[model samples]
Target: MKKLLILGLLFSTGLFQACTVNENPQPITNELLAEVFEVKADFTPGNSFRNYYNLSPVIFDSDVLLVYEFVGLDKTGADIWKPLPQIYTSDNGIHQYNFDFTKLDFSIFLDANFDRMRLNNSWRLGKTFRVVIVPGKFAKMVDKNNLQNVMNTLKLTESSVVDLTI
Candidate 1:
């Protein structure tokens, strides 16, 4: 009877020693699960025939591509919008590139006689641009210049607009 009691006590002691309690436990945090990016573009007025601008991806993954577009009216007297030729940049974080405004080609994006070269003039100043990030896989499968396709790839859930100028 004494031996059995000692063995039971030892077994209970072992079980108690084997138990564990978490220490300094950190609470689990839930963040939105999605592909995200931070985009930036600086439009600087240069000359009538050319301009200089800085384009960059502030926060993005290497497997993604950044598409920059020039958005404005389709024509001088038209209400329609036209997305000008798209410029693509790699996924280097916070890397800025200077593109010669003189090299801008609008053969496909603009209507005939819509002079894109003149966009560097003072009248065309203060234009705010946008950037869209797309997966490299989508870059190969879809046209990055198309906003719809980029939205699809980004899995856009919601969007909001804010007017800071006001």
Candidate 2:
């Protein structure tokens, strides 16, 4: 009985010692930076000229892609140009890429009017920009504010806005 009790206690202690959590989550030490790029002209509608922008997280395995589009319009609600599709890449914890709009080609440009203009500039549009973090590696969507806080704390820039004019 005494031996069994001692063995049980020793096993319990060993199990507890082995079950440890990471007290300090690893910090993103590498300097991560994103640059604004133009999308290829081929992807633009009607081969219309437009401007594009993107923000990529610096950390590898970030899996996040933040994309933005800017279209040039004429006075008559006609699109003179539109942004092209952008691409992003994630390695380990860092993300990086540029949207090359100047190289893409496309068909007709989408019409942009008063109300539509406002809708195009909303957060919903911003949400289209996303990082592809691993399934369990990223914070929950509800914790987006916290994630922003984390970025701020790490001194990481969120993203830059691009301007398009006709």
Candidate 3:
């Protein structure tokens, strides 16, 4: 019993020593983090914007990849919001995408891929989105291959709105 207790104590001590938290974890640097891409979508007639959102492409310099998603229609209660999908700004230089409002015909598109939903130009006057821009390498770092992490990262953006004049 004495020998067993000593061995158990030694083993537990070694185990506790092995479990150490990184006191000085790596800091998020300018390289790891980039300027958040800002997009401002507005309401346009379904007939008018039948093809695509006619807004200027929100471009970034030296920004390798961009990530974003549709936040919601309004900022209040009962707000139609969900983290169903994420929008990759580009694997190419296409940080800008042609927002297709006409896709609202199929609600599943919005449910499955929330970022692709086009603003209901007929029913809703306008819609909003929150975009996060990160270099390709850091994209995975931010999300950690988890939707909840991506969702948490999005909360960093206080609010989302579309500025048509953008």
Q: Which order, best to worst by TM-score?
A: 1, 3, 2
TM-score to native of every candidate shown: 0.35, 0.31, 0.33
The residue-by-residue lDDT of candidate 3 on 46-161, one tens digit each, is 43322233212332443333323344445554334333233333222211222322211101112212322343332223334433444455565575343335435644333332
> In model 1, which residue pairs have backbone atoms overlapping below 3 Å?
none
Please name the candidate that would achieve the greatest TM-score relative to the true structure.
1
lDDT of 2 by residue, 92-131 (tens): 2222122322212112122322222333233112222222
Relative to the unseen true structure, what is the C-alpha lDDT of residue 131 in candidate 1, on a scale of 0 to 100? Answer: 37
Instruction: Judging by TM-score, tell me the better candidate of 1 and 2.
Output: 1
Cα lDDT, all candidates: 0.38, 0.34, 0.39
State the lDDT at 12 in candidate 1: 100
Candidate 3: segments with Cα more than 4 A from true spot: 1-28, 43-124, 144-148, 151-165
- Local lDDT at 111 for model 2: 31
